[model samples]
Target: MHSDRRVVLEVKDVSKLYRLGNIGTGTLSHDLNRWWHKVRGKADPYAKVGTINDRTEIGDSRYVWALQDINFKVYEGDVLGVVGRNGAGKSTLLKVLSRITSPTTGTLGYNGRLAALLEVGTGFHPELTGRENIYLNGAIMGMSRKAVSARLDEIVDFSGCAKYIDTPVKRYSSGMIVRLGFSVAAHLDTDILVVDEVLAVGDADFQSKCIGKMNDVSKSGKTVLFVSHNLAMIRQLCNRCIYLENGRLHSEGDTDLILGHYLTKNSDTARTFEHGPIRKVEVIPETESIRLKCHYKVDRIVHIPNLGFVVNNQFGSSVFGNNTLNSGMSANREFPAEGVIEVEIKSPKLVVGKYTVSIWFGDGQEDFFHEPDCVEFELIQKSTSQFAGSAKVGSVLTDCEFKISAL
Candidate 1:
């Protein structure tokens, strides 16, 4: 991967910073001031930045660094997946590479025709019909009219919008618009393609087509930079991936391993709770024969914030669990000390896997649990059977049978 096979893009220490100020002349003044400093051969006063989480006030000038000290290189034919939480700067990074916006600091160097499907039909002409927009978008991406015409039928068919190929894109549904837009970009004879998660389009079949198209693009020696929240898709589409957190590169590695780390590290349940004492509790499992019995000693009045648990597989991710306070029947009962409390979760549709559980008591919204330790459980195969001895057969168990009611 490190070999010098026409390294197209080299982004070194790239940073994009935006300033905050009262609108109008104040913003004008700040921009002029920064420019004036540059003319004097002196360094820009804003060149140095403070910490990421630095505090600011109404009167004090503030800034946000969308991309911070980032560094990565894309070789020809590499498909790189960029993953992060919202506001993690994944989109900002793509914009920088696509040249839609410039970095506040650092540099990006690349050699190739780079086209981005950032937002659906971003460069489309609302006044034009679908047929017209195709040529227009192609030209905008540095493609000649001849190229667009050559791929016209494929684009229209790929979008499954051929019936509406002559219709104005403005009247097209968002999903249709996305399909057409991606179809255009995918066919562009570009060396690199930058895509942000605009694939929530068409249907499941169309989504699979787009993913397969990207797979083909990488196979054809064209580079791709894909950004998406769906880790499953990222694992399948990319061999290498970059994880961004708080506007900086957090991790980069094999797609599966990197996404696995990113998903857990930045997951919603990544916080610890603080709570005290539990009242009445209910234990529920889908398994009809299985039962859970619990005992609690309440010495004083205390609030149990949230009950939390983790579902883990021997190799990787299973599930992360949390109970909404007072969720379901848990809110209706109270537990007194020195008594056995039995709880039943009827027909829990749990997938076959190992599970860990933790019960907590604290403030409102699961601030903390009774103790830091979690309870554990295991679920073995039951109604499970294997097909040719390969594919998974059952997801969850249910005592289900059927007979022909009518012919």
Candidate 2:
């Protein structure tokens, strides 16, 4: 469907480099070296020497590549989602695309005006009133005074800050600031919108409103680039996604495919788990039942550890959960030093979709170990099932028997 749409934004071989310790090259010698290379019309002497942006390891080089040879295109009306761990360079990629900072290599091509809400109060002056800042932002986007005035009421109403529209922005709370900033960006006359994780500051209702507005914007043939750690929101808002790892685009495709890959990979390495007794967790999803195999190693002896698990859907909502105590297991005996626990949940009645498992080991008195999103799996409906190929009605299927009685 997107094949015929015009490309609104193009990023070709884009990369961003940063020095480790200080803003500039620490030594005059390095500065001189860079100048000499530039004077001779040569490539940056240190551009190719930086390490990838991995925060866990102590690197040997002082230069790191926040973005490396990134390439992608945003078609008109596309809502592209960017996902990654903290140091995976997601923010850097957004900043580069938003033109907040220039790439060290390659170029960006834009066919339309761009407006970004990268940070809270990104273009707002602290001393200016909320009412004035809206006009200021419109001016920055090249809108005329009359044009901004025409949309002023809509912006203030959408922000839910009409009561304090004339208050100085410096006095506004963080949530207020985000509301006004997002309102201005979304209401102003712009063809492309670039939003980072700043929307997380707003309340839940406002976030929902913002998502609805973005959806409207896309339907009108505008483009959007969104970055957030909230996988659930990404799944809901974006039709396509890109995963970044170590300053490079690791994968890009359909939203569900990328999210599945990310969850499975992170679980396999236990990267999201805290150091504890739980070593590994495996989940097997079936039409009739769900199987869980947990591996654990205990260093200190504790009175009877109760093993439990909770199954949650992609939206982070708990579909169902249980612990050993509730399953008629005795809690009088002590836990083994190292062992595996296997659990089979019969007739789970889960609807077709993806789910994640969170495991916890704890004594009746105190908690010992816990891991969230330790494993992820999907459930497929059988061909003979009544609800096969039907639209999802709820998170779980029910076995209700239908009958009618005459009153």
Candidate 3:
């Protein structure tokens, strides 16, 4: 048994293995064959071949390891973020830890109760009403009816779905469904919580509420296991992070450092966008950072191209955008085949989030290059306000003029 003072959860040499082309078609026949062989007291011919625990030797030896010898310990009040690219086995790891699926090998030990929000609507019953499903989900998590009832109002209020408490969950919108399901999971008095990257579905407000709740939960001394593509949120909520890559633990340490390694390891970068013969783009140093500066030039032999920029937030919301033509400004000159254009600004005036810079080079006379999305950046905000207004990382800087008028 682990302890809050020590480690609350420990996974030792844990791994999950699945067979290839080994999916069930006639399981009953296979079972009968095994039973018959056992009754005869003779080893089944396919036994050794079919049931090997070696991940490398399984499934015609073409096996995939969703997790490979993972080891970690989470202490009470520790929030651990598990991040990776798509198909990086992040969800599979959570499934194993949540006991939704059993590991093929290794032992997992935990002292306190665990509640998992693997998918937003995982525990929700479409036929059941919100009020009923709350109790149902609580019971599923090993909570008593009385405990669920005690927290029912809080859950409903938190979900902001009180008016539809008696309505069937099937009638709820996808957003509402996810909200209520997460609320139920959040309210459970568990020693640890595991949430997958599905939080990307909800609106901004709902996401904010989820983050706030997770913060409060962490403060109350519960262990947290979070999986997300939102690097900013992960960095803010988790101090430590584990990076999974191709079914293996790539790195484990501070959130920023781990994510940095994860990104550096798995980044797939393309040069630029291709709209037509008139326009093209090439990223200078596309990695992860808030501030970005680029050079755009047009051919003097052809038409003069107009350049524009759009700065967006992580959620793809266009916070601000401007173009040289609309601003009644020009690039000061035209391009000579491959001339240099310098555009700089102190960027990313939003929370710590992934942002991409959209560049458009067009003739404006007709459509030189059309609006072609180019350049990507990841903005990591400082941990505190002390770092605010200190250093700018993007192009463009503004001097704010403040004046006080009193009557």
Per-residue lDDT tens digits for candidate 3, residues 143-243, read 99999889999999998999999999989987888888788888877889888876777877788789889999989988889998877678778989998
What's model 3's overall lDDT? Answer: 0.71
lDDT tens digits, residue span 1-407, model 1: 56767898999999877665544424667679888988997655665643352223232436667678999888888889998888788898999999998887788887988878888767688779989999987888778899889999998999888999888888988898889888888887888988899886556678778889999998999999999875656766787899998789998878767866774564332223233344333333334633434444555554442333334442444444444355643455554444544445555555544444445544455433343324344343332241112114343445668777776
Q: Give the per-residue Cα lDDT of candidate 1 at 309.
A: 37
Listed in order, each prediction's TM-score against the native is 0.69, 0.76, 0.68
Of the pair 2 and 3, which is ahead by TM-score? 2
Between 1 and 2, whose lDDT is larger? 2
lDDT string, candidate 2, 119-187, tens digits = 988999999999999989889889999999999999999999999999999999999999999999998
Model 1, stretches more than 4 Å misplaced? Answer: 21-25, 41-43, 47-61, 268-407
**Model 2 regions more than 4 Å off:** 268-280, 284-290, 294-342, 346-407
Residue 79 shift from truth in candidate 1, angstroms = 1.4
RMSD to the true structure for each prediction, in A, is 9.2, 7.4, 7.5
Instruction: Report every candidate's CA lDDT.
Output: 0.69, 0.84, 0.71
